[model samples]
Target: MLTVYNLKMPHAVYGGENAMDNITAILKNHQAKRVALFTDGGILASGLFTLPEAAVKAAEAEYYVLSDIPPEPSYTAVQQIVDQFKENGADMIIAVGGGSVLDAAKLASVLVTDEYGVKELLDTPGRAKKCVPTILIPTTAGTGAEVTPNAIVAVPEKELKIGIVNENMIADYVILDARMVKNLPRPIAAATGVDALAHAIECYTSKKANPFSDTFALEALDLILNHILPACDDPEAMEAKNRMQIAAFYAGIAITASGTTAVHALSYPLGGKYHIAHGVSNAILLAPVMRFNAPVCEDRLAKAYDRCCHEAENRCQSDSEKAEWVIGKIEEIVRHLNIPTSLKEFGVPKEDLDGLVEAGMLVQRLLVNNMREVTPEDARNLYLEIL
Candidate 1:
């Protein structure tokens, strides 16, 4: 019984070394005279923007950098960019940060033409649509916002991390520059690497996954399993960091097709309500959610186990043997990355558990993608177990 699904993505993408080198040519082809570059402070400090700067200047275009986007971006922040984009008449947006920055830029592009602001986009009946062309450049190997058709935004008024999911949210161009990520801090690397791992695992076991997505998901999972730890220990290893970047891209492509599951669905509340980083919030919940969903996806988890622990599998004869092997490998990866194992370690109070579950339930957009239906009880239990 195959189910119906839909997938969308970036129109053109440039990856590998000097990929940022192609930005000028992309601008020329698009005839963009003004471009808005969106990034966060971390990326601005890293100075990877120099490559894009030269390209924008070479194109003789008016460029402005908005580096105010935070890890958990709010609609207030998003609309400010939208207002600037419309008032300044900048039609081409080049997002140059991590997932939140790219998502903020994507929303700003969509809302600039409308009479409304951020609140209306979320509350209004119809607002998010393909309006302007955007080019995404990711500095983190975590959220694959570069290629996906959905943007995760914070709605502070509602105290929720809402998603603007639409085909129009896809970037017109995606530029992957490995040099940009070489300076990422160790903690950032581990958190984002876990994020990419979560993305691949969630999408592979998602209810929406199809054959096309399976290809990307398995490859991404394999790469993260093989490379993330090394990338953390040796950021100098161009080979390992490059693989992690590609893994993030592949994971992004996988989610674009198959969608993210309960881990992502449950993570939004922490980001929106508590200002937790998206990757870290997702990271803490990923293992627990997987442990919960494993039964529903035992065969899928077994296959993922096959990817990482082939030698161990030869001695296993039961599903329990394979499940333990799979869980152990995932745990080892988390240990390698040094991501916090518990939500409470990050200041999440036990009292907020109910609200988090409520928020998760309202996040119907992502919950729909879960392989198992996520009830309020299920969401609560997942959080409590992690606690």
Candidate 2:
């Protein structure tokens, strides 16, 4: 039996031109005197800080900025951010970059008002009593961390990338200004865009998928498949980039309701052990896992293709064929974007394949969402095929 679904997202969403102007209003509304800003070094160097910094200054709010966020943030790193947020006596937070920074901010905000450690809170979902109000501004168009209740954090000691899912992690406000995504490089654009697409695809095929998740996922898939290439070709094209950003945000909402499946579950170890960027890892595994799941999900994939494919690709004869066509298109996109298609590119020694499989097996929470159950042997073969 299917359970009724509840969608999760930020309280208010601001986008397009003049979105940054609302920051000052939120600060005042909350009577927030001091604000914490979190971002990655790449965004800090991109000169996108001017607007938000000015907004905070104009509101007469003291701002504390932390821009040293790493590619995939770790549990210890977020704990440090939590300490700093509390130490500065920040009453609110402004997360001002991509997924990593937003996730760091999400974890930090929840930890600031509670005594729970990162592991405890993530491991036990509803323990946090409260969290500081937060406003998220996406400098990059992927990860959809702006409105998600889940945050991905790396645990280096265990060589695993884990999700911290909690309702309190949701941001109070989300800003999606295209100006911030203008300088994204071609590779990052391609990888992150595919990452967003994977979120929609995986959720659409997840066991927990319902009418609401399918609606959001299909819409997100449409937006992403149509505009991803245009956005990559011209980062300065605000229209294309805006569409991709919206696609990512929609996919975020979809996954929050239905959750992601084997693709995300299998990719975590690649991220944690090899330090392959999370998006790239997802890209590598997406096609293979989709192909694996196709036998059981052909009708669903056919429906996805029918809704998302262009006129040129819509003439496929059968559902099985259409499913293969969808898989092929993803491969073509990855090739066009110059993403590495194999684990060997990351130089994983063949002998260590077992370790990767072991790590992937541990992500049963996500694996259970797969339309077809993922067995240990199936996991091994999937990695071997990719290798």
Candidate 3:
């Protein structure tokens, strides 16, 4: 049944506490002299970048620090960073933050060498020309921006989020340091962990999925589903943080290979219109979408459920039972972590349901990946069910 499948990823370097120990050698390998360090203000404020900053300084590479990336990356914001990188003449880029910062750096790194600007790059695919070598160090356990070849950018005027899908956008190196996420806030740990879980689940159930992606997604799902609660309970637990980071990276590979489905497609409008956090939006839509997809994807759901349960045969009598059990487990986790379960609770007015449906319809790229077809009507009903 498998025709073709490919899994893409950066050269990942994983370690605990000593993850940055090899940064110096990596820079030397790339022969990067002038470097641009990209991150957000909050990460810089938290001092997580202190070690990397010191490493760049110690290497005596001419470096410029830009901490102005927004919570959600925008086209205009990416252009500003590109300008800085061009001005500094940086031969290399190092991104250290969550998804937004890493994505912004990815777009800017490739755009800096190309004749095309942000608008042209977003509008045209395969126009990306490889530019400066870049390294991504994630401070959070979610988003998996470290290993993925995709970057999401928001266009405020259009109220739409667009992804730059190009292999050239993938980072040259991904550093997974347990120390960086040791002090992560509880809410972020919960939200990002859920985000990784959604990525794993959606990719596994996507229509394009094949053996390669299934292996990665299931492994990632098992890791996240098992450790998310403990990770949320103890922020400083190194084992939980480490596993979450690896799980997110594995999910990133899965999503890249198979793509995400209706859940991500439906969550986009909330992020675009309400500025709701992406993970929170996904968390709200996860269960309802799974419920809707059950008829077609029950076997897939059951397989995932079995991985979560120690005694699957005794607990789940049928595919329907397994699907419901999986949905119930997700709901339980969301509740325990205090994630709002309804669109209304997330501050979407009842009247705006139609608008949300319209927005969801626009994300055909992700919708087509759903195992079960999701029409505009299906999107509306799913939102209404959540409401």
Model 3: what TM-score?
0.96
Q: What TM-score fits each model?
A: 0.94, 0.97, 0.96
Q: Judging by lDDT against the true structure, name the best candidate.
A: 2
- Give the per-residue lDDT of model 2 (tens digit) for 1-387: 038878877889998787898999889998989888888788878889988898889889988898878889888887887777777768888999889999988888877655577878757867764468889998777988888888888989879999988878888899888777887888888889999999999999999899888988999988887888889997468899988988898898888789899999999999998899988999999999999999999998999989988877349989998899889988988888889899877888889889988999999989999998898899999999888
What tens digits encode model 3's per-residue C-alpha lDDT throughout 1-37? 1369787777655566678767778877777888889
Q: Rank by lDDT, descending?
A: 2, 3, 1
* Clashing residue pairs in candidate 2 (N, C-alpha, C atoms within 3 angstroms): none
Candidate 1: Cα lDDT at 190: 87
Runs with alpha carbons beyond 4 Å of true place in candidate 3: 311-314
After superposing all C-alphas onto the true structure, candidate 3 shows an RMSD in angstroms of: 1.6
Q: Please report, in order, the local distance difference test score of every candidate based on alpha carbons.
A: 0.82, 0.87, 0.85
TM-score ranking from best candidate downward:
2, 3, 1
In order, what is each prediction's RMSD in angstroms? Answer: 2.0, 1.4, 1.6
lDDT of 3 at 129: 73
Deviation in Å, model 3, residue 191 alpha carbon: 1.1
